[model samples]
Target: MKKSIFGILTFILFSMNTFAQNTVAEEIKTLSKDKWQWMADKDVDKLGKLFDDQSMFVHMGGSWGKERELEIIKTGFIHYKKADIHEVFTPIIIENTVILLNRITLFAVVANTEVSNPFMVTEVYVKVGNEWKMGSLSFSKLMGPN
Candidate 1:
């Protein structure tokens, strides 16, 4: 009788944990998509809020801090035309940190020309005071055809 009660309690706890993790994963996934849309729209204000103060962005061209990244978006230095997301992988959540990986074909305008490239984008988010702020964004260029 005692063993049966303990087993039920353990199952309940495990189910709750799984549900919480799934919820976090879905929330982060939505945030990731919103980020791409904000970039394409050049919504600097929203992006600024979503990005952590000390966030780092790594591009094929170079890497920079939050300010420079926001500036680039605001000024259309490299216009993010589209993010054709192929897949959003399950996030790896550890306490206050979450790492989300996405496979996408990104379209951008650079030097007055439009270019599309396949990339694996890594988005790192950290929870702060009930909000999740992007801490890092790194893009890895994929070889071969998109």
Candidate 2:
């Protein structure tokens, strides 16, 4: 009876740990998609909420911080008519108090620039407390259909 009870407890603990890990992965994916959604829609307020005060964003030609990203959004440098994200995949890495989330996002650029560019991107996220924050992002421009 003692051995049986101990086995059950171990199983439960293992299950709980697995569930918790899955939950973190889901949250990371949601945050990844939300970040892109905010960018495509130029939803500055939503985007602002996602960034850490010290976060930095480096794009093709320039780099920006939380405020700078918001500023560009306000200036209409990026405009979005419709955004379609495909093949979104996020992988999670946990280290002590810090969780690292890396994802590949393939999207369509609906507006903004005249030149054709790749929409596929990689985003890095770090967990702080109970929330995950974006740390770095990089994108590649693909040749659009002629």
Winner by TM-score: 1
**Which stretch of 10 consecutive residues in model 2 shows the poorest summed lDDT?**
96-105
Which residue pairs collide in model 1, if any?
A: none
Residues 3-104 of candidate 1 have per-residue lDDT tens digits of: 999999999999999999999999999999999999999999999999999999999999999999999998898899899999888999999999999999
How much is the lDDT of residue 38 in candidate 1?
95
Residue pairs in steric clash, candidate 2?
118-141, 118-142
lDDT of each: 0.95, 0.64
List the RMSD of every prediction in angstroms.
0.9, 4.1
TM-score of each: 0.97, 0.70
